[model samples]
Target: ARDGILVVRPDSGELPKIVLDVLESLAGKFGTSNTPTGHKLLPPKIRVIQGDGIDINSLEMILKTMTAAGWAADNLAFGSGGALLQKLHRDTQKCAFKCSYAVVNGEGVDVVKDPITDPGKKSKKGRLSLEKNADGTWSTITEGKGDPAKDQLVRIFLNGDLTVDEKFQTIRDRSNVGL
Candidate 1:
C-alpha cells in the first residue's frame, strides 16, 4: 500500500451525494489534512474516482458539493467515457457535409439543400473557398468568386492521385496557431 496511492472508485449511486459520503468515510478511516483553502485533503495514500453517470453538469454539481462540504477538489478524479461521446449525435452540433458545388461538362454547378420544413438546415451554395482575412480571421468565399491562388483549402487528392500529403503533426500545429 505504501508503494502507490489507492484509488477508490464508486461506480453506482447518486454521484454528488455518494462522493461526499465516500470522502467523509475515508476521512474518518484514513484521516485528512486541511488545505490553504480550508478544504480537507485526503491522505497521500488514498483518493477517490467517480466514473459513473459523469457529464459536464454532474461533474459541476459534484465539485460544487465537495467544495461546500470542505473537501478539496484534489481528493477526487473523474472518468468520462460513455458520457463524453455516447450522448452526442450529428444534430447536436448541426454538422453535415453536402456537395455545395460541382463541376461537370466544364461548367460549374451550385448545389443547395434548403428544406422549407427546417430553414436552419439550409446549406451553402456555389463553389466555396476558405480565405484568411487581413484580421487573421477566416471566411468562406461563395459563388466561385474567391481567388484560387489565395484559397487555404489545398487539394489533397486529384483523380486517384494524392496531391498534398501532410504529416499529422503539421496539421495539428497549424490548427493551434492562434491558441
Candidate 2:
C-alpha cells in the first residue's frame, strides 16, 4: 500500500510481521482499530520509501490474504485511491484545492478559481467556490454575486497520495508565487 502497490494477486509478499505490528498499533488509536483501519493505515502521504518496487506476484498474495480475512480487495475501496494518488505525485504535480467564503447581506459568496483575482487578493485561511456557467467555463469570483449572501467553499479533488514535489505543487500556496 505504500510504495508501488500490493496488487490483488494470490501471492502478495508475507506482509512482514513488522508491518502488522504497526497496523495494530495504529488501529488501537484510530477508528475501531479493527483490521480494516489497519489495512488502510498509510504513513502520512508525505512519507518516502526506498527501492521496494511492488511486484505483481507479491501483491496478489497480499490481496488473497486480505480477501481471506473478509475484506474486499477492491482498489478504490482498499488501497487504490491512495495508490492512484501516489502515482500522481510520482508522475505530475497537482493538489486537491478547496476554498470557503461567506457573502454579506443581499450578496452571495464570491467563489473564484482564478487565484490572482479571488484567493490571491483575499486572505489565505479559507475556501474558494467554483461557479458553473452556462458554457461550463469556471470564473473567479470577485465581489459577492449570484446567490443571496451564503457561505460557500471549494477544493481541488487531488489524487490524495502525493510525492514531495507533487505535494508542494498541489498546495498552490503563496510561496509558489505568481499564481
Candidate 3:
C-alpha cells in the first residue's frame, strides 16, 4: 500500500537555518499548499530532502531562505555529497590547459607561463581569438591578434584528427545558446 511522498532526509544541521527549521516542522505537521508563486507548498503526503550542507553557496542560501520564508522552491529536494563530487581539482575552477601558440622550427611561437610565484598563474600568449562582441560580450583575442574573420573558434583538434565531431545533443544545443 506504500503510496509515495514521504521523503524527509535532513542529514544533520545548520544548513541555512536547518532548512527553514525543517520546512517549518514539515509545515506544522503535514499541511500546506498556497502556491501561485506565493509559495508554501509542503503537503502532498510529505517531502523535504536537503541532504546536509549541500554547496553552491549552501544551495543559494537554501533557496533564498525558502523564498523569504513563504517557502515553495517546490518545497525542497536537494542532495549533494562531497559538495557535488569531492571538492573537485584543477585549481577548482581556475582550470588549466595552457599552450598558447607554438610551431617551433617553422616559427610561430608565443607561448607563456608567467610565474614569479603565481601571477594568478598567468598563461596566455598568442593564437587565441574568440570574439563575439558588439555588446553581446565574449572576447578572448590574445597575441595572434584576433579577427580571422571574427573567429568563433571551431577546429576541434587537427593533427591526430577528430576535427569536430559534436553530438552530445549538438554540444548541448551549443551550450544552451544565450542561456
Candidate 4:
C-alpha cells in the first residue's frame, strides 16, 4: 500500500474494474465514452441518460455527433439547447448556416423560430417554435420553428413546408463566417 505514485501488489491478482472506472470517468469529459473496457471514440453517437439527469451541453454533443454521422437528430426545444456549432468545424471542415438567423442557437446548431420578423403591420406575433426529435422529425413547440435540423426532412413530409437550409448554406459557403 506504500510505493508512492507507483504501487505494486505484493500478493494475489488485482480487480481491474477499479482501474477501468477511473479512466472512463475522465474520458467522458473530452468527447469520448466510458465503456467498461476503456475510453472509446464516441463520435457520431448519441447517449442520453435522462435517468441521471445530466445537463444539455453533453446531450447536445451527442446530437451533434449524430448529425455528423448523417443520422436524423432532434432535440425537443425543451431538450438539449446550448451549442456553438461553427459555420465549419473549428478543427475540421468549416460550416455556416445559409440564412441570417434572427437568433443564434449555438455553433452549427439552429434553433429556428416562426415569423422570422413581424409581418410589418405587427411588432412580433404568431411565431412558431419547432423542436427537433431523435427520429429526425420536427413539430412546432412554439411559433418559430425553422430549425436547421428540419430543412430537408420537411420537404418530403410536409410538402408545403419551406426550409431555410439552403439559404443558410449559401451564406455559410460565402460569408467569412458561416453566419
The backbone clash count of each candidate, in order, is 0, 26, 0, 30
The residue pairs in collision within model 3 are none
Q: Cα lDDT of all candidates, in order? A: 0.84, 0.38, 0.78, 0.34
Relative to the unseen true structure, what is the C-alpha lDDT of residue 7 in candidate 1, on a scale of 0 to 100? 97
Tens digit of per-residue lDDT, candidate 1, span 1-179: 35988999863566698899889989999999999989999998899999877889999999999998889999999987666668764446867788897788988798988754467778888878989988889888974588777799877877679999889999999999988
Best by lDDT: 1
For model 2, residues 20-115, the per-residue Cα lDDT tens digits are: 333334435542212454444332322112112234543565556544543333321223333433533321343444454545685656453443
In candidate 3, which residue ranges exceed 4 Å CA deviation? 1-33, 36-53, 56-64, 75-82, 89-93, 96-154, 157-179
lDDT of 4 by residue, 71-172 (tens): 333211122212334323321332222232233354333343232222321222233445656775546443344665553323322335745456666757
List runs of model 4 lying over 4 Å from the truth.
Answer: 1-53, 75-179
Q: In model 2, where is the ten-residue run with the lowest total lDDT? A: 44-53
Cα deviation in Å at residue 82, candidate 1?
A: 1.0
The regions of model 1 sitting more than 4 angstroms off are 88-179
**Predicted structure 2, TM vs. truth:** 0.23
Compared with the true structure, what per-residue lDDT tens digits does model 3 show for residues 89-162? 45557667888887888888888887544577687788888889987788888735767898888879866789
